[model samples]
Target: MNDMTPRSFDGREYPYTPQDFAAVSAMVHAHSGICLPQTKTMLVYSRLAKLVRERGLRDFASYIDLIRRDPAERQRAIEAMTTNHTKFFREDHHFRQFERDVRPGLIERLDAGGKVRMWCAAASTGEEPYSLAMSLLGPDPVEGRVIAGADVAILGTDLSGAVLDVARRGHYPAALSQDVPLDLRQTWTRVSGGTMAVAPMLRDLVRYRRLNLLNAWPMRGRFDVIFCRNVMIYFDEPTRERLVQRLVDQLAPGGHLYIGHSERIGGEAARRLRAIGQTVYRKDAA
Candidate 1:
């Protein structure tokens, strides 16, 4: 096997060297569809260093190799890398758009006997998808709809077995709850021990799963709206273009694709998808 020994960093052991980082990045991308940029060396070192020590692995290379071979070890590595930073309704305007523009239009379509499906592609820790569920399933809301939240992490893929254990419990600090609207707060969420959990009604409306966007999507039907936000920024231009095309292919006629505010789909992807707003794309009806 390769030298899987851990290196010392700032008096702590870390996996050093481009080779070590590359190996781990390949493994993560293959399993999760998240592309770790080359500049993210510090991020890799910082995130995985503690795990190395905690697991008593000698070096970064060995640890990665072990993970590659052992399914359980691979799961641990996925857990370490997939811990995303997020909050309820972190991007308020997007949710507002969902309510003010998307929801109304969708309701009109539904009244005409149309059904809707929405996918939250990188539903980190379940905040964005849960927020969407509340918007769609709240009192006096759209009657027929399907919402699917998928992430590459074990928590999401394993049906919230561990990561979602915390998510399903629906507890967050009071500060996190403050950003949620008061009406929404009263109707959509429950508070206990300074942590807020999404109401069961909303939670039940959204289904969470494990899916890697880089790989083939298992769902057969097209989607009317896809929130693949804030995830493509980590991928290379080629990767981004390919991922965008896949998303567009999964979109229904006149469907809208929402990307991260900072990300733009270029190359052939730009031709296939027309820009709708600052960070939104619309597929042609033809």
Candidate 2:
């Protein structure tokens, strides 16, 4: 075996400085809620470098400038940096909790002349909201339930436009149906060319829109359940506190909030919200 180690053809190693890493990390946090760790410097450089090369930019700094100045370029960068690691019912327990605990409570309130509204914040590529749609509407399915999925990125915001072109088509691998029960799979989705699409009836119950959680939320009306799951972990404590409070504001009295398993809202803020179970919170009626 040769003693020489592998090296770049140009003999110039990639330069990843502390400042350079901080700049990109800050940009990511500003645009999306994702917090890039210091260890992810290499990942940021490697992934974004491809964009720089594709756009014929000379370096990372130039690419950042271009993205900041150009709306379309910024959108591409937002899509690139935002984590899209979601699958159908990724956290099964949450869905189960929705069915067993939350849904019944919601239905009781709805029966007493109330309406149910749900927001899926950080909805990536449509799986989370679509899953919620299926669960809330149930098998028989009725109209008029309001389910909204929102994201800050163009790919997420324009979900009704070019962003949803693929999602509207509703194609996922057959393996995705593995978690969904046969009855629900048959009721909510249909297979075409070994892919799955949410049924039109169920799709009509949910609407996808562009929303930036960091900015003023344009939404009107309080919600019975807000599925802001797997998102708050990206923010620093202050940001998290602010976002959590905003989410709580939108929640109707006695409403429910679902977050990622790894996150928590503590102290006085935690007092306003009572823990229902693992990763679930109920807003105090008072």
Candidate 3:
């Protein structure tokens, strides 16, 4: 077994050198704010190996050369490296807080002819945003009537077009629906065979788009709630700080920000956002 070669599950070894790993790391970091430490070497190899094979590339080094010159290939490379590990109510406390605290005001705002918005910054496969929609809309049909026709929008964005496509479809394996509250499941999801689809009423409130967090945001208005959980762990400190500030800027006064349980806000944004709950921050109302 060559130490430099990464062996796949099928016992195929891909030639992945430190130099190749570094090159790929630099490229990924430059395009996306994600930091790729040496620890992720095997992960990088495993994910990109298929791409390398599909393009008939000899090795990661050659694949690196191709990505440098080809914008499209570079994008494919970034997509391959992106981690989209998400599930319905993966962090339940955040949703509970949103449901018990932030959502009521949003409902009131909508009832008074105001528009309400929520953004899922790293929506992976639709679960997080769909979860948000379900929570915001609620399970009790009578209490949910106000929001059922309200002008509320949920924007789910991610860097990967592939995952965004899955999110737009609003379908998931039925087993994953277990995390959804039983009442919510009955009201908002349709189970068929081994798969489930978010109901059209919930789906209609969501819009999926490809958004790079490092790039300029085209959104004009502030959001009442933003779920950017579990995404900043891959970014370096400086990148994470800048991103926190940007997230705060997008927040409407008195709005809420939800992040990964393991993550924290730093720099100026930290001062502006008060820690209201576990991994939850709230901007003071103006």
> Best-fitting candidate, measured by TM-score?
3
Name model 3 segments beyond 4 Å from true.
Answer: 1-14, 142-145
lDDT of 3 by residue, 112-155 (tens): 99999899999988999999999998998666656868788999
As for lDDT, the candidate ahead, 2 or 3, is 3
- How much does candidate 3 score in TM-score? 0.94
lDDT of every model, 2 decimals: 0.70, 0.69, 0.90
- Residue-wise lDDT of candidate 1 within 1-286, one digit each (tens)? 2366534675445547789899989888777666788887778888787777777877787778788789877767766776466667767777777787677777666556666788888777777777766665544323322221211111122212355556556666766778777777777777887778777656665667766666667888888888888877767777888888888888888888888778888877678778867687788887
Q: Predictions ranked by TM-score, top down? A: 3, 2, 1
Determine the backbone clash count of candidate 2.
1
**Candidate 2 on 13-95: residue-level lDDT in tens?**
33345676788788778776668998787778777877776886556677777887897777677667665567777787888
Error of 1 at 23 (Å): 2.5
Off by over 4 Å in 1: 1-10, 37-39, 138-162
For model 3, where is the 10-residue window of minimal lDDT?
1-10
Residue pairs that clash (backbone atoms under 3 angstroms), model 3: none
Count of clashing residue pairs in every prediction: 8, 1, 0
